[model samples]
Target: MATETLTYGNGTSLQASNLPLNGSSAGKPVDIAMDARRVFEVLKNGGLAIVPADIGYGLVAIDPKALERAFVTKQRQPHKRHAMIGSYALHKELHVLPEREANMVELLTRDIDLPLGVIAPLKMNHPIVQKLGSETLARSSVDGTLAMLVNGGKFQDELVRLTSEAGLPLMGSSANLTGKGTKSLVEDIEPEILAVADIVLDYGKRKFSEPRPSSTMIDFRNVEVLRFGACYDVIQDVLVRFYGITLPEDPGRGANFSGHLREAAKR
Candidate 1:
């Protein structure tokens, strides 16, 4: 099968061409109606695809059953589940979080421009979220003008509908291989990863000051910050506003941690 290639220039345009009609188109953008249909066919046939994340882009396997393949390709640990990227409207729909979690989502979506990540509970059982843990699912919005669906297009609702119907939460992560900095264009991705991918919807190079990593991981299960990244301050600020609780300066460990939060929740 012929490989599909896309060129992401400096935030100008994203163009996809030369994609095999029956191959995976997971992480790539599906702008045209035919492209979207063709990609679905390939995915139905067990093909793998890649997609762009808000910061960079990501690999998405066609077979929801084969989510592990995408993670392994990125050399990411199986336990670290990928975040789901969807539209603001869809986020409002699929979200079946508790009042506290729902309140947080409202706050984040209200301030949409700022990159926000929410560690909320999942309503249905999904392989991706289940693999990580049954407690919470992390979600964020993919913002890019060129790549609408992945980048917040009207089709974003379609993507979310498909995923929700399939009972699968997309495992969204940066396009570059694990531990590597976020890549700006298709050419910047590693060849090994690109080789297995079915299609690449290049949006050209992005013009961001620096590669903004995904938001920090705050596990409500543990009520702890797993990793510090882009949305640390914003998350803390939101939590305080909604819960009337102040997070510690250092989220590492001590008397104040998830344990304390859990205890307070019970009270």
Candidate 2:
């Protein structure tokens, strides 16, 4: 299928339809209703939407079939688990958060500037976790269990609306295939990856510091640094001071501690 490239403006302003009337390479977010509709129309039909996220480029898929297609497009491993893009409206359902963890996660990732992913706890028997497969979850889990990624931004509002409209769980994953750099610029995305999308929602290239192309991922349940990219030290500081959480043994080395959170467990 020919992937349509629609020029979309960057940032969190969700007000007013600025859909370009004439032919142009770019436009602001369409009206709230229209924006929600367009995204739903594509994803509910098993199509992929490659768009700029709070982090790097990501592909949003609401079903297993669409997810498979996204994995193939990214040339990712079949068993690799994808992260859920989260919103406040859907948080209670998306995560198995204790009141404390919920409040902490909310405070930590409340910006387009703070690029962090939270791996919150999930019930092993939960429908979404079961459908995602225990094996996949185990592989990606900090503790070899089921978890979710909280990629939050103002854009999450539209995602919340889309999920409500479609009534399907969503999977918002990095656009890159396994082993590829998480690309920040539209053109930096491999054409083969872009071609698989139903449409490319261009909000312009993201402006992030080097050595970290994507968000840093940590365990909300244990506060272990899973993967360090952007805002690594700052998040570590916040977690330590506010929550009495200890820093990861290998903070920026992307070490996996088998989900152990206690500093004494480090050896």
Candidate 3:
């Protein structure tokens, strides 16, 4: 099949290509760096992009208007918060977690190599947080905490590195319509969502496709299970064994396919 090229509202065109799943091939490293750079350039300038994650595909934007456009495109609820695309370094710099909580984040994201959405209090004075400005923050944050996804995948890791270095932040939710289960492959992403993206990075099928479409989200502040998503059982086991913290059992995807315990957990 011919490689597809897409043009976005930003006037830049992106060539979409198939990436080897999990970056398994020798060519994957260079392919990932190049694709990440392309998507990063789009996001940095307020353009939207559909990018793959281990948990699922995601819609990310940096500019407030772009963020609003994505929210509208997804028909997202007003109370739903966008998650920050993050790395271990940015999490340490941005989240003000206590030692124990911080250690848990390190173990899960770094040691265990899990894909997790970590909600924690943020450092208001952090440059990236400051750069987000008030309008974006209002939509992307909870009371005083921000949800950040760590170790989502290699492409996301590279993208976060660029955002971190530039002191910008990428924020968005699953690459699907509101209340719709997450899409693992770019092609499976809905037409509305695809139409809004300035570019789409087609990484083929992702690591953690449905019936679990997103990363397990936790409010480290209270060790609450906000969303029981991809790798829930694995994370639960690790927490129980290492920290003796027993998270509430995932009610199974059939009961909670959207992965939230409540509408409030949509963060």
Candidate 4:
């Protein structure tokens, strides 16, 4: 099928008509309509698109079937999970997490400059979340400017509407091969990934700093840090302040780390 294209503008008519939200398609090749709502729809329909972030642009696909194809194209392992991004509205549609976890989501949504990820449980069970483990879900949000690149202005609302309409949670992650540089445009993506993609949204070329490895993942299930990444220190501080729990000083095994945190708490 021919890819659909939509030019986002400042007009509210598009939002009222839900035109951008309706354009997203799954299982069929559809060019990104260029609106955040539309992109969300495309993702919900199992289509693939590219998103530009403060750090850089990455690939996004909401459909599990499409994601499987994306992983193969990027040579990404199935065990490694993807992240999610959208407006606050989109975040609310996700699983109803604990207040503390909800607070984290609010904090990230409030700060447009911080490029962080939220690990929570999916609102509902699905093969994707099941594969990642039931204890957590991934959530993220790009700055408004980045949202505008895809959808003119109502980026957040559009995202919420599309996801709600499709009843699918999106998998957000950087668009690059594992341990390789992230591609900025649809054309730059490795051909392997492109071949399996149902839709390829091109936002043109962009310069990016050395890709920051994936965000550190924390399993709120036990309120423990799982993998340490760029946001480790920040997450540590948050957990400590909010839950009165301290993390380990040493950056080693769980036994050692937990022991360290316990020792510090005692003091």
Winning candidate number (TM-score) = 3
Q: What is the lDDT of candidate 1?
A: 0.48
What overall lDDT goes with each candidate model?
A: 0.48, 0.61, 0.81, 0.47
Instruction: Give candidate 4 regions above 4 Å deviation.
Output: 1-34, 37-46, 82-87, 111-113, 125-160, 181-188, 198-213, 228-267
Off by over 4 Å in 1: 8-41, 64-66, 82-96, 125-158, 165-169, 206-211, 221-223, 241-267
Deviating ranges (above 4 Å) for candidate 2: 8-33, 111-113, 123-147, 207-211, 249-267
Listed per candidate, the RMSD to the true structure in angstroms reads: 9.3, 6.4, 5.3, 11.1
Model 1 lDDT per residue over 1-267, tens place = 444653432323223454332212444333434444444445445565555444445566435444556667778754455556555554555444566655555565455343444454443443534533323233222221101122233333454556555654544455657767556555677876777676665544443213244444454433454444444566678777767757555343243232223433455
Q: Report residue 102 deviation for candidate 3 (angstroms).
A: 0.6
Report lDDT (Cα) of residue 119, candidate 1: 51
Task: Pick the lDDT winner.
Answer: 3
Ranking by lDDT: 3, 2, 1, 4
Query: Candidate 4 on 75-114: residue-level lDDT in tens?
Result: 7655555555554555454445688766665664454223
Q: What TM-score, over all chains together, does every model reach?
A: 0.61, 0.74, 0.88, 0.54
Q: Over the stretch 164-210, how does candidate 3's per-residue lDDT look in tens digits?
A: 89888888888899987888766677888887887777666789865
TM-score of model number 4? 0.54
Residue 169 lDDT, candidate 1, scale 0-100: 51
RMSD of 1: 9.3
